[model samples]
Target chain A: MSTTVDRPLRADARRNREKVLDAARGAFAETGLHAQIEDIARRAGVGVGTVYRHFPTKDALVAALAEAHFAHLADIVEAGARREGDAWEVFAATILDSAAPTAGDAALCEIIAGHPQAIEAAALGQERLKAATGALMGAAQRAGQMRDDATVQDVQAIMCGFGQVAAAQRAGAQMDWQRYLTIALDGLRAR
Target chain B: MSTTVDRPLRADARRNREKVLDAARGAFAETGLHAQIEDIARRAGVGVGTVYRHFPTKDALVAALAEAHFAHLADIVEAGARREGDAWEVFAATILDSAAPTAGDAALCEIIAGHPQAIEAAALGQERLKAATGALMGAAQRAGQMRDDATVQDVQAIMCGFGQVAAAQRAGAQMDWQRYLTIALDGLRAR
Candidate 1:
């Protein structure tokens, strides 16, 4: 009887947490770092106290989002690595897929660019991303499909740069990030 | 006698204006957009009234600085165009030179990334830069030295993206922008 009662309660708590995160992601995507906790709680169909129970603060919410983003990126990299294809094709596709702008991208960019401390909170996810990307980079380099001089760090910087360019475009700058990505991809090709 | 007196006053005002600009540039580079006008006045060895007299507001000061940065980039592009070298070499040199990080680069990146309205104030300077870079890009493309698909706007976006990467590096991210630039340049190549 105790296990049955606790199990439902735990499931309810987990569902509430997921709802809050989903609402917060949408809010942050639209308004960026200035998105309010109250708005996110209302959107989640939860009281503000529930939001505080899960995240404690706006920074905590953002940190959780950042961790999720890193995990998503790691999954992309791992999937690309698993694909049986030309090394260069796999590497380039991974780069393009990871860097392609999405609604959630703006919030990740803001967290990376403005909230360095939040990154610390996402270290486990970041480490997973780093390991996944590093393995892919090594395979591509060993196959002579990508420049040997480029490091995993270089790829991360390029992706981060792409995020900034995309954010700027969304903010009304007239430029295409796909073109920019193409040029960068060419630059990464092995001589 | 009246003309002579007015000439000296004008000269003094111009000198004060230059000093304030120099101080503001240093301050903005070190502290970004959050730098205070009073601190800039103090660094310039002028009264707060002097800075206000010359710039009126922080936005105006930043706009002036942005215009100056654009003009400087225009000068660099024109000088590269005038050089006697392989069109590709000249184009690459110009891009690298312009994108090379400087103390003032951080402030320029902040303005370009954060203040779109200020760009309108620097339209004339931006036009000159566009013309100069366009001519260089045309020459390179015509010589079959650079990728023909790229537009001048593409080049500008890449440079702006590079600026953001450099700024982030300055903020303690361990990344080498020179390597990033090299990869981008390769992407711009005709091959």
Candidate 2:
């Protein structure tokens, strides 16, 4: 019985790990960085012991949350940048899509805004973002699909604005956030 | 002696009220809406008694905070919208100016986001904002400065995005926030 318990527990631990990440992401999104890990465990349908085993501390969990989002963002950017679509279109679409309803986006953003460690991780994430945005901008400029004066920094700014719109949408405070992005995109397109 | 004392106290009360608002705005900007009222009083070089006496409650103080900002925003938008500058340019500039470093912008934002009461008060504020933004869009559309398809809803979305950029700037989390607003503005402008 003891041997059987140990073997099954390993599988349970793996399941709990994924569960913990999912719950932590949801809790952090709803309540920001200060969300209680205990609540996260409950949301994950796991015991506190399982949560602790999967993520020893909140910071570790936060790191994981941000890391997951960053990886996803990087993949999206890479894929989009390689596509034949207009560079700006692909870049803007990827950003808008990443910010769209996703499991961990809120959690990722909360961590970036409120946690030092997460911000540092986001710095690395930003580097990748910069590269992807740059590639898009360069392509668009070459294609005469974007203005020559635009910079990657400009793309970064748009992302910041996008975040604002996204936040308002989440809070149920506004419904036009996406429309504003479209308006701004119109301004950004080749003139 | 009693009359004399009352007169001086009334004058003192007025002075304290001004001080509390100033300090609260600064504190809110720095620490978000959670900045303590007592700290605000202390920063204003006044007693907590004076703060409570002048504003009665934190909700009252927060309402005053939102009201003041909304009024100011309305004024800027109205003034800018009425000006001879191109519609799109004025719109972009007005939104950008709001994001610039100011003494109380952050605090004002904090009071609105940190407290539910302040957010409720924001409806009136939003109405004012809509009016101002609508004026700008209307004029821009008339002048062929913006796309005919644009609506006030589009401006509202940009405003929400601008708010996020402003908050991130206040938190020092975003450096490119304003630039993105400019890029987005490009999309809103006429072809």
Candidate 3:
């Protein structure tokens, strides 16, 4: 009887946590790190007190979001590596797919570019992402599909560059990333 | 006799103005737009009153710098186009050479990325830069030596992206723009 009573309560807590995280991600993506905790709580359909219980501060929430972002990126690269196909195609597809803007991507880019403290909190997830991308890059290079001179670090820098371009476009710069990616992908190919 | 006396005073004023601009460029490049005009006046070996006499305000000074930046870029592109060489080579060299960081580059990137007011103040310079680069792109594409699908705006976007990567590296991100530029150049090449 004790286990049954505790089970529903624990499940309710878990569901509420997930709702808060989802709402926070959306809020952060749209309004950036300035998104308010009260607004997030309202969006999550939870009380402000519940949000504070889950995350004592906005910084803690941002760190959580950063970890989730790295994990999502790692998952994408690892999944692409697992698929049996042309290594170049897989690599290009992975990059292009990941570059596709989701609601969370703006938040992820902000964390990577602007929040060093949040990144420190997500160190483990970043390591996982680095390892996953390194393996994929190695496989692509070995298959003689990708340029040998490029490092995994180089790829990361390029993606950061793309994120910058995307952000500028969103700010009304009147340029698109599709052609930019095409040029970058072409440059990445082996001579 | 009065004209002769006025000539020397005018020349002295011109020299002082140039010194202030040079000092401001270095200061702004190192420390961004927040660089104090007092410090710039000191660096230029002039008084704060002299700085105010020349430009009146920080915004006016920044606008002047922005205009100079665009004029420099325009000169580079127009000069490159006039050189007798492969159109592609000229285009690539102009892009690569401009992408190379100089003392004023950080300030240029900051102005381009962060200051809409400065850009507006330099509208005529920006228009000249656009026209110059557009002619170069058109020549390269017409020669069948550059990719036709790309636009002058695309080139501008890529440079802005490169600027973003460069800024991040300066902030201690472990990446370099040399390899990034190499890859970007490769991408811009015609197959």
Q: Compute DockQ for each candidate against the true complex.
A: 0.56, 0.49, 0.48
Q: Per-residue lDDT of A1-191 in model 1, one digit per residue for the tens?
A: 46555434477789999999999999988877788899999999999999998888889998888888877877888888887778888888876787653423567766654457778888987888788788888888999988888777877777767767777777878867777777787787887
Q: Count backbone overlaps in model 2.
A: 7
Clashing pairs in 2: A157-B180, A158-B180, A184-B184, A186-B187, A187-B186, A187-B187, B29-B107
Q: Over the stretch A129-183, how does candidate 2's per-residue lDDT look in tens digits?
A: 6798788778888988888887765655556566545555566654554565566
Which model, 1 or 3, shows the larger TM-score?
A: 1
**Model with the higher lDDT, candidate 1 or 3:** 1
- Checking candidate 1 for backbone clashes, the offending pairs are A187-B187
The positional error of residue A89 in candidate 1, measured at the CA in angstroms, is 1.0
- Segments of candidate 2 deviating more than 4 angstroms: A1-12, A47-53, A101-105, A109-116, A122-125, B1-9, B98-104, B109-119, B173-178
Candidate number achieving the greatest TM-score relative to the actual structure: 1
Winner by DockQ: 1
- Rank candidates, lDDT, best first: 1, 3, 2
Worst 10 residues of 2 chain A by lDDT: A107-116
Q: How should the candidates be ordered by TM-score, best one leading? A: 1, 2, 3
DockQ for model 2 equals 0.49
